[model samples]
Target: MQGSLSEDRRAQGEASAGLIRGELEKVREEGGSGAYGVFGEQRIAAALKRLGCGKEHGVYIGNGFYSVHTGVVCVSGYVTKDELTSEVHGAYAEPQPGTGPCVENRGGH
Candidate 1:
């Protein structure tokens, strides 16, 4: 059972990697500013979940810029559990002032 689970996780990771690669290809083909929006982020998060990455896994969307044009937009983040936790915690610790409340609190008041 353990071996099977490991194999499943591996397969999921591979599939996720492929999906991410496809997104990257699209961004490249569209000249970087292709507008991945939340689509790529959701894909990465789903892939991580499938691979049993847990909340400690961080999924980052990175964009590069060049002269008068956007460069490649890709996943420049790591898949390590520790790094993921750090990334998430760091983001939470930072204050986004002037953003006008959190998304969850928008409709409360």
Candidate 2:
């Protein structure tokens, strides 16, 4: 069961990469004539990478950066339920969408 979960995560990551790439392409196709801050695609990539999605997952940009958790929340702050679910579903088989708490490791020696 654990192995299946891992595989599912990997697959999810790959799918996420595909969806993100498509969205980016759409944005590019639309063409912009102004400066831009980090946006949804960037944020999504950051979050997915932080969640253990690797480069092979296709979430990394040419600059070799992934979506940090903060980036995710920033881009998705205005997401609707249907949109959020659709986007998240592209990755995980389960709707476990969230940047779970991050705990620091302390030495216990």
Candidate 3:
């Protein structure tokens, strides 16, 4: 039962990652115009890498937000779609407290 649950979560995370990747590609192809344009694809890519969701890593999306979690850090944010432009907007990274290295090491001997 536990194994199945973990598998299910992994599958769900993969699906969400695919969706986020597709959206990101669309924004990049469109020259990063709109809300997504502000941060630009490169910046997003860097954040994703830091969060362990770069091209070589996996992403996790939950409740309409995309996130990447490394052992020492996590970054989560939303990718709003622009109805008019059919592009992604408002893509921002929200730092997860207590997940970063500093937080994890706090008060540790």
Q: For this target, which candidate reaches the highest TM-score against the unseen true structure?
A: 3
Q: Which ten residues in a row have the lowest lDDT in candidate 2?
A: 73-82
How large is the C-alpha RMSD of every model relative to the true structure?
14.4, 12.9, 13.2
Q: lDDT-based ranking, best first?
A: 3, 2, 1
lDDT of each: 0.30, 0.33, 0.40
- In terms of lDDT, which candidate is stronger, 2 or 3? 3
Please report the TM-score between candidate 3 and the true structure.
Answer: 0.32
- 1-109 in candidate 3: lDDT tens per residue? 0112255555554555555466554544565445543434454565455434653333443323445543223334554344211111212233233332111222323
Tens digit of per-residue lDDT, candidate 2, span 2-109: 112255555654565455445444444444313333334454454455545544432333222233122122111212112222222222222122322111112233
- The positional error of residue 38 in candidate 1, measured at the CA in angstroms, is 19
Query: How well does model 2 score by local distance difference test?
Result: 0.33
lDDT of 1 by residue, 1-109 (tens): 0112245554554455454444444433443223432233444444444544333333333232100000111122332212221110112222223221111112222
Where is the poorest 10-residue window by lDDT in model 1?
65-74
